[model samples]
Target: MLDFAIFAVTFVIILVGAVLYLYPSSRRASGIPGLNPTDEKDGNLQDIVNRGSLHEFLVSLHQEFGSVASFWFGRRPVVSLGSVEQLRQHINPNHTTDSFETMLKSLLGYQSGMGGGANETVIRKKVYESAINNTLKNNFPLVLKLVEELVGKWKSFPEAQHTPLCAHLLGLAMKTVTQLALGERFRDDTEVISFRKNHDAIWSEIGKGYLDGSLEKSCSRKGHYDEALSEMESVLLTVAKERKAQRKQTVFVDSLLQSSLTERQIMEDCMVFTLAGCVITANLCIWALHFLSTSEDVQEKLYQELEDVLGSDPVSLDKIPQLRYCQQVLNETVRTAKLTPVAARLQEVEGKVDQHVIPKETLVIYALGVVLQDSDTWSTPYRFDPDRFEEESARKSFCLLGFSGNQTCPELRFAYTVATVLLSTLVRQLKLHKLKGQVMEVRSELVSTPKDETWITISRRRKHGEQQQN
Candidate 1:
């Protein structure tokens, strides 16, 4: 089933590209107002391609059409909802993290549920969720220790030294995720570095390989990619075996070992958590720091909140809720960056968004980018203002889109905790400043990132007594 899902998606992508090349236009199938296919075979795919990404295309589509819109991917009609009202009508309570699961499985070449029964599948998912949740609760001290180590590294730098924000955060995320997810072996810098190298090799080929048939076309790329994947699986398998033999229940792999999952199932879940957790956590921290650097007032306000809430003390899990402003900053960063800009689901049964009837099995897109920056929903939506989320209604609206609240997926919730801990620690100590004339552009993809290597310089904040003496 997993393999078929992967193949079907890849086939559709190729088929869409082929059809778009052959045909020039497609008519709308739903009542939702949106673009007709620019080409008959391609549908609106060429338009999406021309815009560079789905997020950009949807932004323009929502602007032209309205909150509810429709488009085509080859011959299949896609319904996109760009407003809270539209999403409320379309959102289903039973929606699981199937998309995230599928993407991770495809990227890692992990075929899940091979010969496993439905009960086993359900148990495996429970284990996966339990591992993450338990890690956050049980291993938070380890999390704090790792983040403070990052802070210590930054402090060691000479005052006002330029730092590569993305690179450093990615490293921090890798350490934290691997240590908590895989095992304590990742505590070694050497191990983390090797894991990251293999991770990057596989990540670089994610959409380029089996999905597009490039892996089959390029022998060398395929060989290197397979080698990296094999190395990663080997590492995960070793960790699982160690945990099972030792009967350890300290880390994420231990949780999986406690379950009845096969070695393959355990390894795949670890891979999914590692991949998603690192990327999302790294990007979230990067954006938070970038935005804080650009706005002195917001940064200062955040620092003040930290001081007022946890003076001369470290941020702990118990005190997280008290640091409400920190949560606001993280939420606003997610909104402003438009991180994870697009999410999709296949309509299980016929659905209705407003008056539009979405056909069963049709593709439904949640145009989160369009909704995040919608002027009607947010005041000065483009502005980096954390105060905007101070409102309960705003937070509720944000949660409605699956960015936060109980609705947020486990990986994202983990990220929020990690970002909160990092921000609370870093802001209280270092004063972050953007490089002069640095212009950062958002590259919306699986996750949003700076279009280029973003550089920032930091200076140590003066102590309260030192300021008074000065």
Candidate 2:
């Protein structure tokens, strides 16, 4: 009897040890609170699906687990920081690259030597940043021309016509980003429409593919996505090849061609810029217009700021900085829209957050959307009040999340300038009004966009400086 008991005890110990080794729970990761893997292979993926999106998942996780939480991403464990305090502990401004780049690259399935190593990443990052800066500085006139074209289209519409705000802005943003980032080839309507069609197909699939592994499961869907992506690549390749042969560097693509980057590297970075630039710019402008439509006071204040800054002249790049109230409105729009819901950084080495030790090489998420809406961080977090940003502390808090300052991505900086030019030009000439009984619902994915087509009406402003009646 004693011998039998000893053998049974030894067998149970081995089995338990094997189980723990194969599946380490969140408790094993740290003292932080979070969900464990529901399935041995899937981890918390099903939970993410149940919660709708990664953004929504983080929202619920932070709500339940306080400022810091941990959850398994397949076999990998992810730590999410959802408060300014948690972010401050984790962010190192000196670090060259961030989780946003890493995550974006993964989602796009971009395979290149870009960001392959520390030194390569730093060099490429600088070139990419310079490209955007040069494009914006050299191409301000092009931006104005595009904005003017959009304003002209709006002017041609009937006074009470219900305008498709999201669609119109998306097309405008695509045209602006494509022309500025790619080349004047985008100036042709046929090329722009073709590129936009391919872009929409690819973008629509990317987020859904990343979340559910649906692309791999559905062969037809994956094939269509690849076809669209191939078309986009073809367009970029032709443009890049053309730019390489040209003597003068004119647009964003020209900057890349002038660099020592390989053709593949150039394509990778340009793809990043083009995809992120269009989506972010379009959604930012959409939310800005939607918010403006809902608030007449905000709209009037913005117009007054524009009037004071430039009575009848258009928004110039130099004049952009002087429109402080306009900047606040954009800042508030980003905050309220939660434009980018989440960004992640791989923990280079083991790090500490408050009392917890983050594992080395762990994927650390900056739950930016949650932090943006945190009641502790903002007063009446749901309110779309631009006045809140008038305070220095509010701006500082925003900068910490990588929305502003040196940390802002190249695309975001470019988008802000484009948005400022577009908004300032539009608001000065038109009175924007929301359609009756139109309820705007947010569909938060890689970007936060309206769930349905948003419609608005516009009336021309009088030359006497009087606001037009909606």
Candidate 3:
């Protein structure tokens, strides 16, 4: 089911693209009046594409088109909610992570009975969350070991040299997730490398399907995606079969395999999360670093918080809470960078948010990028200011649609755990400096990244002459 749906989406998208080329999409709104907050502005495919960058384009749409608007991606109609109230009304109760429960069910092969509301599934998710949280803490040593290697390499770099943060962070996230997901076998460096390549291929193809229409037009590209997926599933299935009876196993895949779901369902979810974690977590880590490097004051504050809390001690679960400044920095980075720019949810039932009437089965997208930067919600929405999060009310009042941990992004806390550990460990040893040409520009995708590779230079902290012992 997962495989078919993946290909089916690609095929349908391609067909739609062809149809649009032969016959341009009409300007008339398929949705109701207030539904298009854009007020029936320029939502043509030509305009969205002509804007060059979709992220910038959406930002413009919200600026020009009111807070609510409807648009089309090929034949698919989409409604974007960009304001705090609009998002709150729609997303607070109606938002979902990775689309709605039914989509997740169908894509992940959950039987009709299991759903987001299902007691058994909910219990299983909670159990997995607890287990994973504990494992991340107990497993700090593994994370630190990797961090030390990265730190060592950074310390080796000459002053003012550039380092590819995206590549490094992606590697760190992939290794950390795999080691936890497939223990013992993680030492298989060759297998780990294979997973990374295959993972990147599929993720890239999915992103490309929307931009270049290659997945729909090119059979070879689609075949490549299929092949990479097969390789990934084989690795996951092998790990699951090997560790099925290993009660000591406690990674994500192990938890899913132990659940009441079918074997195929477990395998699909494992594959989805493995790649999902790498992409989103990698983006988060790199963006956090970018924000830190750009702001010397914020960097010092983060370093001070680390020293004040840990004082050269290795980062651990207990110390995580005290890293308040670190948490604020991450929150600020995600908001400023708009790491998760776009997420869509299907309106299962006809509903109304404010004056807008949403029809059943409509795709309601929340432009987190727009909401995260709303002038009404954020005092200086465009600025990179972690201190804004200094006020507890800031985080509470403003709903970071896609980054919120509740339903929009279930993996946020998980990403937070991974990011906090990485930041605390590195900030303790090195002072992050932005490279000469490296500016943090948002390159939006499934998960956003800096427009260019975020290059940063590292130097031993002035205060900490010698690195403290773990």
Clashes of each: 9, 1, 3
How do these models rank on lDDT, best leading? 2, 1, 3
* Candidate 3 pairs with clashing backbones: 36-69, 37-68, 37-69
Candidate 1 C-alpha lDDT tens digits along 315-389: 898899998888999999999998778767667578777678888877787888889988889999999999998
Cα RMSD for candidates in order: 7.9, 2.5, 9.2
Location of the lowest summed lDDT over 10 successive residues in candidate 2: 23-32
Using Cα atoms with residue i matched to residue i, what is each candidate's TM-score against the true structure? 0.85, 0.94, 0.84
In candidate 1, where is summed lDDT lowest over 10 consecutive residues?
A: 206-215
Which candidate would rank higher by lDDT, 1 or 3? 1
lDDT for each residue of candidate 3 in 98-167, tens digit (9 for 90 to 100): 4423333333334423445546555645554555565565576787788778778888887667788988
Residue pairs with clashing backbones, model 2: 99-344
Off by over 4 Å in 1: 1-45, 74-76, 98-126, 205-227, 467-470
Model 3 segments more than 4 A misplaced: 1-48, 95-131, 211-213, 398-408, 464-470
Top-scoring candidate (lDDT) = 2
Write one digit per residue (lDDT tens) for candidate 2, span 93-139. Answer: 32677556667877787642464677787888899999999999899
Q: All candidates' lDDT scores?
A: 0.81, 0.86, 0.70
Ranking by TM-score: 2, 1, 3
